[model samples]
Target chain A: MDLQVAIDRVTLDKAIDLAKQLDTQVDVIEFGTSLIKDYGLEQIHAQLPKLQHAKLLLDLKTIDEGEYEFDKGFATGDILTAMGAASADTLTKVYALSQSRGKQLFIDMMEITADKTAQIVNHPAAIYGIHHAKDSKAGFDAAATVAAFHEDYPMVQHISVAGGIDLTMAQKLATQGIAESVIVGSAIVKTADPVAAAQKFMEVMHK
Target chain B: MDLQVAIDRVTLDKAIDLAKQLDTQVDVIEFGTSLIKDYGLEQIHAQLPKLQHAKLLLDLKTIDEGEYEFDKGFATGDILTAMGAASADTLTKVYALSQSRGKQLFIDMMEITADKTAQIVNHPAAIYGIHHAKDSKAGFDAAATVAAFHEDYPMVQHISVAGGIDLTMAQKLATQGIAESVIVGSAIVKTADPVAAAQKFMEVMHK
Candidate 1:
């Protein structure tokens, strides 16, 4: 499994610094929804330097105006996310746009019901992100969540699991072979040395 | 009935100019989701002058990170919107935050199923906005939609309807007396004179 380190709720300068430091250590560097909504795609595009090693993902969490958000988001990041709860038309439009532009769309599956999930699983190329809401006080079991989701929809090829992913859970997910990528936020970014933290997670996943 | 004018897909300068002009004419001046994502709440907060007459509503469409988004959103806008499809926990957290601050929360009920709607209809102070996804090519009948919604969820007060609301539709909604507010976007803002168009909408609603 690939380690996707998410940088969130931090200043742009700090986010850029962390991204630069963790670029080589992780497979994908996500500028979290907080970063995108706080600074915007235009400002982020203007400020953030191009990454040399890792892929860039911006958690746009787009629910409506899919084309407009995706059009601007693609200018900066390699992958942009849209909410799975969005209408089929919105999802279809953005997925097609991603394909046409040779970029990727990550469908953020947060608070989406199983019935809704089953219907929107037709995007073969799009990454189906099983996200846990950050604001929820409830406990999240990343591995079990991924396991259940995979069992429910084995057809979804590019699966990614996010929210409260620690080293142990990361290793378990990597071993399970369901999710292609595991997204780590505070565990990696909030550490004393994000680069070192990311390396450790990567080490565990690879081992 | 209240007229909520939505300013979207424009430069920040244009948005501010339009907001300034429409401040007194409309009951509420909405800086749509486009404005918040394009310019950001912080930048908007710093730039936008306090509205002298109309209440400000920023369509944050916040799906997660409720407290963080609401804290920043309430700094500038009298009302902030959250997606109705968000987790129940997220909705509760933001609702409490809004209540604590004595501001309002507008729940954008776009693509939310009837079952989900029944679950989240408890926030009496929160305006339940019956929104049609702009990305969808499906035609919308604003008054009919609001009436149907009201019939289904009679307990839900402070209903706000949006999506392709023209003069006739606005008049019909006003007469129906179910929706307290009708949100008009391009019908007003895309006109030669936005302020004049807003007056025409207000006239129709009042008549």
Candidate 2:
């Protein structure tokens, strides 16, 4: 029942301020893909040094050039995510690289068909992330989505869920006890008091 | 055939210098994905203005948030690329956006399967880029690869190829008459005289 707060679509200074504020409070602090593409990985890496408690996950969403992106991502943070819809070869190679480096890989299961998921369920150590695209117009019951994913791929031990998640929904997920991490982006980061909002989420998640 | 000189893995100053030298010489001056990630797109756009003769193609390799990435990419240049391995929905949205903006789309068919290729060949206006991963341990034969891709998807009109393409392979691909553009990266950019290397490639590709 860990909380991952994602900061995105903001200026580099604001993103750094938020990262510094929430570093020791949250279980994982994600510098969202927009931040990475907007500010570049090197800039983020230079601004945010080694974390004291929380893991730093850079949402790279790499679809190709796994080795180069993974190497660069690992230099800055502890975990990186790749699209599940990428070629199985690329996914497998990235997983091997992550395992070898003693880092973690979060497989973003966004827009992937069931068949594609079946093809890539062999990576035991990798975290299978169930996500609904922010732009997706379709309705998603996050808890139900996680349940279905766990049933479909029982072998995947670690799972993460994200997309439009609020504190109540996060508590529901935590009570379900299947998802290893609950990712809340705008719901927590966009509030007037992000730190207080994050604390509220932590309270509900641990209750 | 057109020569798209990809300037990658070089410092921004060096890339700007080379682009200035080859601005009017090549058919397309590509700011590669490495440069895009090394420096933000805004900086890249500000640093490298439009080419005098050639179109500027920024290889965003966008896999998700198609609208946001395309909006940002097309703001800076006339052409952008999306991963063919991306969902058909993403590709379609990006293609429509590019068409509306009077720009171009280059679909990077790097690690996609044949079935996926068939599903994505409907975008006639998009250039189907045949690229081999630089980090691939297996050998790459660019000209031969284009011949096979053309045979498989004969309906795809605009074809582009990039790998470790040399002057000889560029000439061979030119004679083959399948690919509309040949992308050469390190072979030209890393050379002592990048403009001279580009001129040699243009010569070989024309003949």
Candidate 3:
């Protein structure tokens, strides 16, 4: 399983420093939506040097104007995200664009129902991200959620799970082996030593 | 009725120039989602001298992390937007934050159903923005949509409409007296004289 580290709610300089430190430690480095909205993509793109190992994913969470956002987003990020709650037309356009550009598209399945998920699950190349909303007060069992999702939509090829993910949950997900990747935000990025925290996560996932 | 001139997919320089010119001509000046994604809020806030007359609305299109986005967004904008499709928790937090700060919140009702709308329509102070997704190829009748929305949700007091709005539609919406504001994008901003185009919209809306 791949480890995706999400960096959010920090200054651009700190985000860049964190990304550089974790570049070799993780499979994917996510510049969360807060970073994008706070710093803007132009500044982020101008300042970001290409990573030698990790793929860059910008959590654009694009709900509309998929083509425009994806086009610009692909310039800096290897993968970009759109909201699963967005229109089918929007998802289709972004998916097509991503395929054309040989990039990846992550569909953020936050606040979407199973019925809506069925409608959008046909995109085999797209990664379906399952996570609880940051604002939701509900408890989340990442492994259980992944298991249920896989059972419901067995056809979904690539699955990613997030939301308060820690080392234990990461190992559980790795053992379950249903999720292609696990997204760790504060667990890794907000730690005393992000690089060491990421290395620890890597050790557990691979153990 | 109010006229909101949506400045999108343009350079930051041109957007600022157009906003300054239309500050007195229009009721609101919108920095569209494209601009936010392209230039970012930090750059936009740094370069923008506050508008002397018109209110500035940043289309943050926030789906989660409501408090954080609203906190940062309210610094440079009098109004910031959140997705109606987001979880109720997100909507509640952002609405509360907006109220506490004495700022405004616009809920983007793009692609939401009446059932979901019923759940989120309780925020009386919030502006319920009705529009079609930019990616959808289907035609949109802005006045009719607003009229239907108003009929369906009489409790929703403040209404705003967008998507392919022109002079005729603006006049119709104004005459209907249902929508509090009509948002005009390319029709006003793409013309040879954005100020004149905005003036034309203002005349029709106020006529």
Candidate 4:
């Protein structure tokens, strides 16, 4: 499993610094939704060149106006996300745009039911992100969730799981060999040493 | 009924200029999702002082991490929006935050089922936004949709409707007396004379 270190709720400068430091250690570097809404895409685009090694994923969390957000988002990042709850038309348009541009679309399956997920899972090129809402009081079992998701939708190839991921969970998910990537947010970015935290997660995943 | 003129897909300068001109004419001035993503909130916050009249609504369309997005959004906007499709915990956090600050939260009800709406529509102070996805090719009858929504969820006190609202549709919605506000986007902003177009819609709604 690839380690996708998410940078969130920090100043853009700090986020950039962390991204640069963690680029070589992780497979993908994510600028969370907080950075996008707090800082804006134009400014984020200007500062995107700071990272040289890792792929950049901007959590746009686009629900509507898919073409417009994707068009602007692709200018900076390698991957952009759209909410799975968005209408089929929105998903279809964004998926087409991402494919045409040779970029990737990550479909955020947050707060969506299995019935809805079945309708939108046909996009083979898009990454189906199994996101746990940050505000949920319930505990998340990342490995179990991925296993269930994989069982439910055997056709889904590119699966990414996120929310409250720790080193143990990362290793478990790696062993399961189902998820394409695991997204770590505060576990890496909020620690005293983000680079070290990321390397630790990377080491566990690879081992 | 209140009229909300949405400023979208325009340069920040033009949006500010239009907001300044329409501030006195409309009940609310909205910085659409496009503007927020394009310019960033800090930059938009810097320019928000120009509006001398009308409440500002930032369409944050927040799907997760409610508290963080709401805290930042409420800095400049009188009202901020969260996706109705968001987890109950997220909606709850944002709703409480908006209430604590005495700001308003608009829940964007896009692509959500009536069952889900039943779960999240208890916040009386929160405006339940009846939105049509921009990507959908289906025709939208704003007045009819609002009437049906009101009938289905009679407990939902505050209702706001958007999507291709024209002069006739605005007049119909105003007469229907179900919606608290009507949101107009390209119809008003894309016209050659945005100010005059806004005035015309205002006149129709009042009449």
Candidate 5:
């Protein structure tokens, strides 16, 4: 299992500082959707230093104009995200673009129905991200959610789970052995010591 | 009927220039999603001169984190957009914020299922924007799409239509007496004279 740290809703300077600090501590460093919308890709690309290790993912959450967004997004990061709720044509365009460019596209399966998910699950190279909306007053059991998702669509090889993940849930998910990566946001980024928090998560997940 | 000119895929300088030129000519000046992602909201807020006549709409296309996105988006523009495909919780949060703040929230109905549309059509104050994905290869008839949408959701009073809206389609939609506004992109922004193109659209719609 891999740990993906999501840094969100912070100053670009702070986000860059965190990314630099945790570069080798995690498998992936995600500049969350808020950061992208707040700082813009051009500015982020200009400011963020090259990571010596770990892939960079921008949570673009693109719902349309896949080609244009993906083209611009790939110029900055290794992985970009698109909404699973987007039309089949849009998903196919981004997926193909990601493959051709040797980049990665993560399909955010947020607020999508099973029928819709079934339609888009054919992209083997794409990562399917599962999570409840952050604003929703809903409870999320990450391990159970991943287990159910795996049962529903066993063909989806790469799966990433996010939403309020802590160390215990990370270890549970790691033991369950379904999700390829786990995304932790406030748990790692908002702590008193984000680097140490991230290290703790890494230790538990790899234990 | 209103003419909302969509400015997309251009340099910040060019976009600001276009907005300044078209501010008085159109009812609404839209900074498209591409611009928002290319240049962050803080930069846009710092640079964009306040519109003297027209309202400004930022196509945030927000799918989640509704409160945070809307809070930031409303600081920069009169109208902010949220994806109709977003969860009911997300939509409700943005709609409430928009109403409380005395601004407008446009629910983008791109590629949303009819069932989902039915669920979200109750927000009377919200502008329901109907359009196909710009990346989709499928055919789009703007006027017809609006007509069908209006017939199905009579409760939704404010409607905006986009996607390949030209002078003829704008006139047709205006005459059809359904959509409250028609959004035109390349037809207006890509022309040799954008102000004249926007004037032509305004002429046809208001004729």
Candidate 6:
């Protein structure tokens, strides 16, 4: 399992500093949706040279104007994310664009239903994410959500999960043997020691 | 019925100039998603003067991290767009933020299915937009899409439409009497004369 450290809700200078610090250790460095929308992709493109060793993933969460967003997003990073609930056409267009650029697309499934997933499950190359909403009023059993999603759409080979994942939960996911990537945001970045937190997560996930 | 002239895919200087010119004629002056991503919201916030007559609508096209995006978005414009395809939590969070700001939220329904629409049809304050993707392989009949969507989700009071609308289609949507707004993008902005094109569309839709 590759460790993807997601940085969010911080100033660009702070985010860049943390990214530079973690680049050599983490496999993927994600500029969370907050960074992209707050600072904009143009600024990120200007300031992202710090990510020399790790792959940068911008959580674009694009739904429409796929070509425009994906084209600009790819200019700034190695990977971009789109809402799986985006139009079939939008998802397909971005996926194709990512493929053409030899980059990666992470399909963020924040609130999409099982039926909708069936429609978009054919993207053999894209990563289908089982994400719990950040602002959800409901409960998020990340491990259970992954198990249900896997049972429903087993063909969706490259799966990822995010939302309320701690090192314990991350380890549980690893032992479950489904999700290829696990995304933890505040649990890591908001900590007193983000690098130490990430190292602990990496140890648990790798175990 | 209000007219919103959206300026997109132009240099920030040109967009600002157009917004200034169109501010007097239109009810809303929109900086489309292109401008936001290209120039970044911070830059646009610096360039955008407080509109004396028109309400500024920045098409943020936010798909996740609703609170952060809406917060940043409202700092610049009177209205911001979130995809109907985004999680209910996302839509709800942005809607609340918009409500608190005493601004508007335009929910773009570009590629969402009917079932998805059922899930998001409860926000009476949001303007439900019926849109066809620019990257769609098949032809999009905008009036037809709006009429069908209105019939299905009559609870959704305000409706908006976008996708290759010409002056003729604008008149047709006006006569159809469902969509409260028709979003004309490249058809107006890419024309040899944008102001003339916008006036012609306004005349056709309003007459």
| DockQ for all models | 0.66, 0.52, 0.85, 0.86, 0.82, 0.55
Q: Fraction of true inter-chain Cα contacts (below 8 Å) kept per model? A: 0.55, 0.41, 0.86, 0.89, 0.75, 0.52
**Residue B199 in model 1: shift from native, Å?**
1.0
CAPRI-style quality class for the chain A–B interface of candidate 1: medium
What are the runs in model 2 whose C-alpha is more than 4 Å off?
A: A113-115, A133-140, B132-141
Clashing pairs in 5: none
| Local accuracy of candidate 5 as per-residue lDDT tens digits, A29-102 | 99998998888999999999999998999999999889999999999899999999999889999999999999
Model 1: pairs clashing at backbone N, Cα or C within 3 Å: none
Clashes of each: 0, 0, 1, 1, 0, 0
Q: How well is each residue in B13-96 modelled by candidate 5, as lDDT tens digits?
A: 999999999999999999999998998888899999999999999999999899999999998899999999999989999999
TM-scores of the models, in the given order?
A: 0.95, 0.90, 0.96, 0.95, 0.96, 0.90
Q: Give chain B TM-scores in order.
A: 0.95, 0.93, 0.95, 0.94, 0.95, 0.91
In candidate 1, what fraction of native interface contacts survive? 0.55
Tens digit of per-residue lDDT, candidate 1, span A36-94: 77777778888899999999999899999999999988989899999999999999999
lDDT per residue for candidate 4 within B8-96, as digits (tens), equals 99999999888988999999999999999988899999876756779999999998889988899888999999999999889999999
| lDDT for position A97 in model 4 | 99
Residues B55-157, candidate 6: write the lDDT tens digits.
8888888877788888888888898998877878789888988998899999987667777778888889999877644445454577778877888888989
What lDDT does model 3 reach?
A: 0.91
The deviation in Å at residue A176 for candidate 2 is: 1.2
Chain A (candidate 5) TM-score to true chain A: 0.95
Clashing pairs in 2: none
Candidate 3 ranges beyond 4 A from true positions: A132-140, B132-140
Task: List the candidate 4 regions with Cα displacement exceeding 4 Å.
Answer: A132-140, B132-140
Error of 2 at B45 (Å): 2.2
As for DockQ, the candidate ahead, 2 or 4, is 4
Tens-place lDDT digits, model 1, residues B1-207: 999999999999999999999999999999988787777777898999999999999999999999999998898999999999998889999999999999999999888988898899999999999874344445547666787888899998899988888898889888889899999989999999998999999999897
Q: After superposition, how far is residue A41 of candidate 1 from its true place, in Å?
A: 1.2
Q: Which lDDT value does model 1 have at A97? A: 97
